[model samples]
Target chain A: MNISLQTRLLLLMSVALAIGVLVTQQAGRYESRRTAAADIDARLGRVAHTLLLSWQVSNDLTVASIPALTVAPPAPDGKRLPVFEVTTFDNRVLLRSHDFPLRTHALRAAGPGYGNAEIENTRWRVFTVIDSQRRIICRVALNEHDRSLREATLAPHFDQPLLLGVPLILVLGWMSLVYGLRPLRRLSRELARRDATDLAPIRSVDNDAIVEIRALRRTLDGLFERLRHAVNAQRLFTAAAGHELRTPLAGLRTQIEVAQRAPDAQQQTHALERIARAGEHMEKLVSRLLHLARLDSGETEIARHTLDFAALVARISGDYARVACDGVDRPAELQGDASLLEALVTNLLDNACRHAPTDTPVEVTLAHHDHWLTLHVRDHGPGLPEADRARAFDVFYRGENTFGEGSGLGLALVRAIARAHGGHAGIDPPSRDGLCVTVRLPAAHRS
Target chain B: MRILLIEDDPILGDGLQVGLQQAGYSVDWLADGALAADALANDEFDAVILDLALPSRSGRQLLADWRDAGQTVPILVLTAYDALDDRIDGLDGGADDYLVKPVALEELAARLRALVRRSQGQADNCLRWDGIEFNRASGILSIDGQVLDLSAHERQIITALLERPGQTLTREQLASRLYGWDGGPESNSLEVHIHNLRRKLGRQRIKTVRGLGYRMAQPDR
Candidate 1:
């Protein structure tokens, strides 16, 4: 059940207390009652022996049959004392105690053992024994009302302490637990007081913190530290992105202003040409940013479709001159998103065209082997240095000699599109001075 | 006036240089921070337009180095970082002024003129002699109350002469002021400009030295 720890503990302790008290109470009552009853029976046997001795003495001395004396009634104050009787063998009553107006066969029924009898509507426990030497019988009895195992003395002693201890133990247990859990409560309160932007580490409230509490605090501190780093990194990245975007914007504005205030037609034309270049640069930057954003955000699902890979490459490479497509006539089919695939081929061609020398031709090679399709785009331009080969696919990483209009996102987007189709892209050194990129995709036949 | 433009971006640098040059200030461009620092140490510029992020070194480092060396040339920081912390740091680290990118060319020119004037301790932004008035901010030349139209080359030459009315300047010095580190027409062009100026202004206003180039005549008190 969804219960608090304190309440749950209290509930379990209370149930244990109830069972403990019940067992002890019942066992005590049973033991005490049996002991009291046995004690009462022993006293009755002693009294019977005493009475027989006294009667035997009186009968042997023949002292006028004990002078027919009458014992005084029991001591006052409504106590039903034990009663006794003496009788001869012929069923004659010699003496009796607890005097009653009428007696009916009290000494004649039981032979020589303890028995129960009703005399004047009062039940009695009778211990009857025969005195052979005195030729008489002696019987001592106690009424059921005078039984020792009543609910008076032991009830208060046994039940009162346990009943009172319930509240005491509950309150004390609850208080001690609250003290032990103080650190946890303090931590929660401190967390609740923090603002959303506050990622500071939580501090220890005391010098002697428990190990569990200390461990919890350490975990929380670690999380907050990571969050702080992430936030700072995001802020820095946004600032960098803003700076990159604004530089081109500033260029475009300055060029437009220059054109507007040009002194002559030739100067105006020069400014306009720069302005057009600035526009092109801005367009490339923005489109690259959008592509990266879309890829990161997972907004565009990679819709799988079967298409001719060779045909796609040929169609995209049609824009660039001196592009020789080898092994591209066959219908090399693969399952991937059409639009994303189109973008992928276009970016590969764009990178090749930008890097390749004007007169040299860009080479496109597409081939399929075993359940995989491989495509290569090669350019005979200044090959990238080995040091820059690894990070060349990083977004916005422009090479040292790179100029305006190179957004530096072409290879990065190509790799992203290639990976979305359960494929990989990598760079390979060409035979001579050029950059050759290779992409591998799972062919449709694999399925 | 002349300006040194230190920017890493090719398109922005080329455009800003052209705009500033067209506004009648000779502009020299540097694309690397180390080269910029070296040029500032050797040559003279009326003002400097610095981009904060650059290759070889950062603009802030150069600014600190220049300020530490007690160079009093006015520096205007032009950068794409619009953050408050960046601005505060740039200004507090010895920059004469700070501006975010995408600034209007006219505003940039005006700020540069103001920076130059302030460094020269000219409060009214005007230097007057021989009944001729020049406003640095507008690059406007007027005589007394009437405005006078002059070509860009003539305006530059006369403005330089007006700043130092009693000092004679050589032809190379004047040409260097009009075109910094870049080729201009030959020395005879200076004489043609001087001829054009003498035609517009009185002959006595521009005194031609035999060996030295030219000087504005000291007005009679």
Candidate 2:
């Protein structure tokens, strides 16, 4: 499933905290048990010393009334108590406690130390003390089970902190997660409440402590800014296009109305001529609009094939041979979309025809050097100023002081078509009293 | 019929003027919305064909101003805004009818006729007086079962008289209907057309009151 970031972080923390609690609890138990056993052994050694001093003062080795040894009180439940034995070097037991378990084997006579023995199924901690001058041995042992019982009495003390700490950690972890994710939730809510057409940037909240979230908000704001500009540009273009289309349509309607009510053949012919011109203008506008839209959408699939660039130029030039002259230096070949290339050439020639003087001949030239194949179209028209050269290829941008009527989409479409073939188009610096537009493409490999 | 045309575009304004004039409407074209408003306040027109986009003042603003001033002239809105909301706005803004641009000239004329007829409390396309029936659409007059051929000027005079039968029409009113403000009446042009009209329909069909003007003679049912 898709777990949220907060849940994932909480889950990881919970697992780590669980392991910490378990390890701490076990170590507490082990250390407390060891310290308790050591404490018991020290108390037993002190008691044995007192008993030895009494025996030395009396100067008697025979069995007699033994002094009452002050021992630890019995387990609270009265199950077991501290036990002891006094024995000689010859394996004879001289003294013993009332509760000491009877054993069949003789107690091993050894140096004074601490050890463990199992008299029955129960285990015990044994401490031994010896008086070598008197040949007396004193051994004291306590039930291991009793020590565990005492440790258990202190169990709640250790457990209370852990029991309280674990839940506190979980609650604190969950609360922190909720608090930390507040900014993201606020951003989502803000986005959801906005209108579909509202392209305004999301306002960033001040005092956001998380750097990553702040960065994310900045990135989103940047994206929204770009989208708003694009949307505004598109809206302006559509509005302008609507106004442009209405002008021609209005003209066409007026001309047709005039034609319908013309009084004579001469007037009818004049009206018919205007109507035809308006229709042709509308047709050209519509076709250019379609081409520009296709290019803007970036979805036109280009079918590329290897074709002779010089021959293609020659063929295209033939269509405009009456007004345009061609110069093809050598046979240049290129791989590109044929229809798009033809459109590009046609748009260039048409643009020249519309702008250039009727007497001047438009020039078309093609040359290839190294991997680059270039096509150039020069027109003897009122060339664009240096500032307008860059913007002239923008959609619907008309040049200053241009001749004849045009849609203003031809040069833009030419640039788009050229770019689609992995090429570039630009206005070359004029070497004479004319304007030259050049398109450069990568030449196809001979193989 | 007199019409006030408020349009900014010169070509469209000229074309509409010509076409509407040919359709027998005396059109007073105004290129600016403020001028149109001023003219509307001072002049009497049967209907108005208003363009939404205009110079000096927008058409919508002028319409609002006119309606606020209690002008009840039937208005037909002409605009290039073909969206549904634009039509709704135009109608809700007190326009009697709405037409998108590039509308057929015949349709425009018909719509104007319908608007004028409705203003005059007319229900059908034919106006009848006695045995004569006038078809508003074709501008043709028929008596009994026979159609009468009439000149454009004679047709205008008969249409004006037939619109309100039994009511006396002043000579000035009849002259204004026959020729627009620009065309001055000749000394006996109205008399000539009236004579022609009376000769074609019987002389008893029209009665000239002693100094008032003319009225259609009512025939007994």
Q: What is the iRMS for every candidate structure?
A: 2.4, 5.9
Candidate 1 regions exceeding 4 Å error are A1-152, A177-181, A259-280, A308-334, A341-401, A405-419, A423-447, B29-44, B55-73, B88-94, B119-121, B129-131, B143-147, B164-190, B207-212, B217-221
How displaced is residue A87 in candidate 1, in Å? 14
Query: How well is each residue in A16-59 modelled by candidate 2, as lDDT tens digits?
Result: 99999999888777766766776677767876776677667765
Residue pairs in clash, model 1: none
Best by TM-score: 1
* Backbone-clash count (model 2): 0
Candidate 2 clashing pairs? none
Local lDDT at B182 for model 2: 59
Candidate 2 docking: what grade? Answer: incorrect
Candidate 2 chain A: worst-modelled 10 consecutive residues by lDDT: A103-112
